[model samples]
Target: MTTDTASPIPSDAEQFGKPLQGWRLRLYTIIFEADTRAGKLFDVVLIAAILLSVAVVMLDSVEALHQRHGRWFDVLEWCFTLLFTIEYIARLVCVRRPWRYARSFFGVIDLLAILPAYLAALVPELHLLMDVRILRLLRIFRVFKLTEYAIEYRLLSRALANSRRKILIFLSFVLMVVLVLGTLMYVVEGPEHGYANIPTSVYWAITTLTTVGFGDITPQTNAGRFIASLMMLLGWGTLAVPTGIVTAEMTSMRRRPVTTRTCHACLTEDQAADANYCRHCGAKLSPYQYDREEEQPVRR
Candidate 1:
């Protein structure tokens, strides 16, 4: 190969269609820290933010969320949003291939995470919707960016995308359950028992099922407590649904492992046509060779 030092190695964004060097890479790395580690971190942060946001919501309803504007919590949340905003921008640059990156699924994820903050900032009125964390939290998938570049990960991605509808249906069913339970809890516990509204109570149901108890609300009535206990037990299965769905798909599409090295007895490396056996050392190289050879016209 002729060397051309004069030729600037295409930027990493140019080389692998992503920039892994420069300040942009650094920023993105800090955001991810590991394989989807950045995304995982983002998940942890957002999870915290959402929990905090939810707490704030419930506290506001129950008149409990604020103790001096939650100075530390507020500071932490702003820091997280700022970090994510920087990460979002850095990734756009890291994915210097605007068209390629933008069209990609994870590219969309990266776009989604930060858009809300900006939207909230741009239009203060919409700020009210900022803490609607459930829907917006899908932005956490941007962490998939950490693994998006690998060829091996394609199987996992394909599996998830293929099974998405089924997973969605399952989740939908869970939502229905939550809705029903929320309504029941609200009615049974009454407005004063912390099931203030159906939706918030439904959120409480989801939190309970996912075992993410934030301790924000409790069923004050004995009957409501009994129902809540049953729901809590049932949550184990509800929480496992998505995992089970994905695992089953993964098992079904499991790739067969192929040995790259030829067997020593065969002395063949994925035998080519006309190959009878090892050219250097004769061996039974034709287990499937006979079958393959039969498919081809034999030279007389």
Candidate 2:
């Protein structure tokens, strides 16, 4: 008789359960990946919940509505808080390194979105600051979670990043101009003419430069008015500098080809498809091959 030996196949419990595998993998995909139908559905529903919860929070702020529907508002808020709590727990459960996700920008935002209501419930005296619930509004950024699925947002983000230094310099120049103008206006108009001090004059210069025209403070002297007019003129030009810088960067980025492959190490998406390295973090990237014959030129 011949003896035969065969090895047993490992179960999912043995693989995924040990290190971010199994049901956790499926949960992670549904919660974080936009490429799959299930993931997309999850995002859509989550966004809807965020919007609805924000709307309820807004209505709860109105005194008349709060007095009449206070109980209903409390119920809705608790329900939304519970949903977000579950989502936060799910995210932690699915990740191999939960702290990494917890420390990420969106992870912190997700926690803030639910914390205010729970805090208010636990500390009734803190109800006065219920407006903190409005921080949940940051959840609107969750829409960016879909950026990995789009090319335009990727290019836009890249262009903004490229233009950051130029924009910062322009903003610094604007701040210097405002400081100079504010000091001059204070000297020209003096405290008697409603230019109370340097700080107050700076406030006036900022409002005028931004064209907010609050009308609370007005220059009473001819010299101050002239200075205000010049600042106002400069503001229009200042507003365009960052725009032009970003647009120029965007033009250059648009001319280049893009890829949808996300970086696993940095979790960054939208690298150039043919790139051997991530443009954002310089991590290694694997390019997926496409059928050149079937690929058509993309028109901007």
Candidate 3:
């Protein structure tokens, strides 16, 4: 008797457990998936709009420019805000669970991109927050579909995560050193030398230890100067400690090859190079293809 193997099941579904179809499916494909030409174009245009909006907000801060082009800047700001508002709504409408996505990192960022404009009348200072749209530019990494860059970013992120504990301990030690040195300076230099109190002295200690000598405060006494010299020397070595820790962690990691293929079910990217299913959602992945054109040899 001949036996047949069962075909893989499709797991793409909405929050209500229905498969996405029609316009919603098409919109999701274009908005969430960066693998297609239309999707890439959308992302590029969106990124450009974000950058221009941020520039408008920044230029508005300059008194001279604001006075000269204030009216034009206001119109441009509202135009960009309206565009982002529609994009944000489309993202919500296309996703399976709107509430879930609204609570996600990118979703929050998308909302922030348009919120400042609406609230600009209530609090004029909030208009400056429109610059947060610059964060949306991170989408560029996925839009280009550069597998190597994505892998490197993942590697660096992993190294940093693994080194977090060591880095935290190093920071704690630095904090204690600053506290002790700051108190000692306050006692030796006293209020007359600008080491007015423990907190002020701690600020000086931080600036000195970071080698950022603001020159607003100084150690007048010989004992305080000696301590400052020691802190300065210590800063040089401190700067390299975190770098070495992260580098060592990165070197010990085994780099896995990954693809820019994004999972349709959950919209996760960075799937394993040979994966047939989404690692995050177990959805059967569609055929993976390179977006870039392969070089062809010259014809004889």
- lDDT of each prediction vs. the true structure? 0.58, 0.71, 0.72
The TM-score that candidate 3 achieves is 0.67
Q: Candidate 2: where are CA atoms >4 Å away?
A: 1-21, 125-159, 251-255, 261-300
What is residue 273's positional error in candidate 3, in angstroms? Answer: 1.4
Rank ordering of all candidates by TM-score, starting from the highest: 2, 3, 1
TM-score of each candidate structure, all chains considered together: 0.44, 0.70, 0.67
What lDDT tens digits, residue by residue, belong to model 1 across residues 25-126?
555443423223454465466445545543443443332344655555445545655765665566666555656656666667666655654665577655
Residue 23, candidate 3: how far off, in angstroms?
4.4
Q: Model 3 off-target regions past 4 Å? A: 1-26, 121-162, 246-254, 262-271, 274-300
User: What would the per-residue lDDT of candidate 2 be over residues 209-228, giving only the tens digit for each residue?
Assistant: 88888998898888888998
| Per-residue lDDT of model 3, residues 66-98, tens digit only | 799999988997798789789889878877778
Best by lDDT: 3
Query: Candidate 1 at 114: error in angstroms?
Result: 14
Please list the Cα RMSD from the true structure of every candidate, rounded to 1 decimal place: 16.8, 12.9, 10.0
